[model samples]
Target: MSVTSSDPRIAGARAAPKRGIRFSWSDPLFRAIIWQIVIVGIVVGIGWYLVHNTMQNLAARRIATGFDFLDRVAGIPIGESMIAYDSSVHTYGRALVIGVLNTLQVSVVGIILATIIGTLVGIGRLSSNWLLARLTAFYVEVIRDIPLLLQLLFWYTMLQGLPPPRQAWSIGDTAFLSNRGIKLPLLEWQTAYGFALLGLAAGIAATIWWSRRASRVQEQTGVRPSVWPVAIGGMVVLPLAIWALFGAPLVLDIPALRGFNFQGGGTISPEFSALLIGLVTYTAGFIAEIVRSGIQAVPNGQWEAARALGLRHGVILRQIILPQALRVIIPPMTSQYLNLTKNSSLAVAIGFQDIVSIANTTLNQTGQAIEVIAIIMAVYLTISLSISLFMNWYNARIALVER
Candidate 1:
C-alpha cells in the first residue's frame, strides 16, 4: 500500500466524495434539477402570457369580471333544489349552492347504495352456485361495457315515459310515482331529531373504536370480547335514548293532490330519480368487480386454515379473509367513489340541476364563463379531496404492520 495521510483533515478530505453540485451534464442529479427548474419556468411563463392576454381581451370588450356577479340577481330558474330558490329573489351564489346540495345528495346516497349492492353482488359472484355467479358476471360485463351517459339517458327516458302526475302510480295517496317524479310524505325534521342524528353518528364512531380495541384485546390475550352487545347499545340504544330525551318529535308532511302536481311533501324529480338510479347501478358494477378481485386476492390457503379451525364459511369470510382483503379493496374503491362524484356532473345531460348543470346556466345568464367554470372546478376539487383524504386514512389504518 502507498503511504496514506494520517492527519485527520487530509484523511477526511481524501475519503469524502466531491461536495457541492457540479454544473456538468454528466452529473445526473444536477442535470435533473436544472432541467426541472427550466421546464417549470417555461410553464409559468406560458401561463402568465395566457392569463395576461385573456385579461387584456376581456378589458377591450368591457366585460366585467370577478365574482361580484354572484351578489347580483340570479334570475335563473332551477327546477329541482334542496333549498328554497326563487329566481326573482335569489342570487347566482344561492343557485350554485343549491346545485352543490343536489349533487351531494345524489352522490352520498349513490355511494352508500352502490357499496352495499356491489359488495353483495361481488360475494355472490364468488358463491358456489353456478347460476348466481354467472348472473353477477353477466351484470358486471354488460354494465361495464355500456357508457354511463347512455345509461343515464336510458333511465331518464324510462322515467319520462311513465304516467303523468294526474294518472300517476300511487300507494294510498302517501306515495306517488309519475313522469313528474316520486312524491312521498316528507318526515318533518325537528331539532330533537337533529340531535339524535348527531348521537347516532357519535355511536358509529364509538363502535369503530370499540371494534379495534376488541381486536387488540384478542390478539394480546387470545380472548375476544363480545362486541355485539356494545354495538347494539352504541348504535341503537344511544340514538333512541337521545331521541327520548328530546321527547321524540314525530311528524310527517303528507303530500296532497293539487292541480297538475302534488304539494305539501317532497318530490324526487324524474331527473333526480333517473340520475340516482343510473349512478348507483353503474357504479355498483365497477365496485362489484373491485370487491370480487379483493376477495380473490386472498390466498385459498386462508380459507382452508380457517376451516381447519372449525369455522363456518361466513365466519371465515367476515372474520379472517375480508379483514386482510381490505388492504387491497380500499385503494381502488376510493377511485370508484371519486369517479361517481365527478360523473355526477353529467346530470346536466338529463336536466338534473347539479353543479355542472347550474354552472352552465349561470355561465349563459351571467356571461361570466371564467368565474362560473372556476366555481365548478373548485366544488369538484373540494369534494374529491375530502374523499381521497378519508380513504387514505382508512387505508393506513388497515395496512399490515411488521412485527
Candidate 2:
C-alpha cells in the first residue's frame, strides 16, 4: 500500500507535447491576409480586363481620348458672369467656370434664405398657438410632398404669364415687383466706397472679437453680456457710419419705363427668380423637419431648469436648447444644402444657364458625350466632397464624446 516517490502508472501514461503543424491554417491573422489577397486579385483582374476592353473599343470606334476638348471653342453664351464671355471667344473651361459660379450663386443664397425660413417655420410648428402650429405643419407637408420639378414649372409659368414691362407693377417709384420678377435700384460706386468696405470689414473683425470676450466674461462672472450691441454694431451701425462718412459714395439708379421695357436698373430675370424660389421653398421643408427633430431631442428638463434659473424664453432657447440641438441639426442640414446645390441643375429646364445646361450645349456641339459627362460628374463630386468634409468637421467639433 506504500506509494513510490512518484506514481509510476501516472508518469508512464503522461503524454508528450504534440509538435505536428504548430501553425494551423485556420489562424485568424493568416486567414485575413489570405482573404484580402484574394479580393484584391479579383478586383485588379476585373479592372484590367475592363480597361483593356475599353481601350480596344475606343480604338475600333476611332474616338480619341484626352483633355484636349477643353481647349476647343465652347460656342455657348452665358447669362450672367463676372467676366465677358461669348460663344466665339470663350474656351470650354471658361464656360464651365461660369456655370459653376452660377450654381454657387444660387446655392449660397438659397441655403441662407432656406435656413431662415425653415428655422422660423420649425419654431412655429412647436408653438403653443394652435393656429401657428397648424399653418407650419401644413407648409411642411405640402412642400415636401410635391416634386421639385413641378414646383419649378409652376413658378416659371406664373412668371411668364405676367404683363409686359410697360405694365409691370411699380413699388413707390423705386422698386418694381412683377410676375416678370423683382427689379431694384442699382448702385453706382466710387473710390470712397472702397474705404467704407474696408472699414466695414474691420468692424466685423472687432465684433467677432468682442463676442468671444463676452462669452469668456459670462463663463467667469456668470453675467451674460448683451449680444445686441455687437450684432447691431456689426450689421448696421458700422455700415451706416461708413456710408455717412463717405457721403454714401454711390448713386442709385432706378428703373424707368423706356420704350417697350424698363431700363437702367438691375433685374432678377424671370427664369432665375423662379429657379431660386423653387429651390428655396422645396429645400426649406426638409430643413424644417430636421430643425424640429433636433430641438425635440433636447430633454424637457433642460427647459425647466433654464426657467428655474430665471432665464427668459428667448435666452433659454438660445443658451441651453439651440446650442445642444445644433449638434444634431447641422449634419442633416448640410445634406439639404448639398441637395439644393445639385438641384440647381434643374435650372436648365427653365433656361437659367447653370453648369449642366452649358455642359449639355458643349456636349452637343463637340459630340464628346463621354468627356462632357465625365466633367459634369467630376464637378458635382468635387462640390459634394467639399461640403461633406466641412460638415463632418463641424459635426466633430460639436459631437459629444464619452470617456
Q: Which candidate wins on TM-score?
A: 2
| Candidate 2 C-alpha error for residue 296, in Å | 1.4
Model 1, position 102: C-alpha lDDT score: 90
Candidate 2 lDDT by residue in tens digits, 46-108: 999988997798879998766798898777777766467887988998998888888888888
Candidate 1, residues 1-403, lDDT tens digits: the string is 2337587766654443466567788665577689999999999999999999999999999997999989989998889887888999999999999989998999999999999999999999999999999999999999989999999999999999999888989999789888999899999979988888898898889889999999999999999998888889888999999999988888999888798678888888899889999999999999999999999999999999999999999999999988988888999999999999999999999999999999899999889999899899999999999999999998988884411
| Candidate 2 lDDT score at position 302 | 94
Taking all chains together, the TM-score of candidate 2 against the true structure is: 0.84
Give the clashing residue pairs of candidate 1, or none. none
Stretches off by above 4 angstroms in model 2 are 1-31, 178-180, 209-248, 257-260, 400-403
Once all C-alphas are superposed, what RMSD does model 1 give against the true structure?
A: 6.1
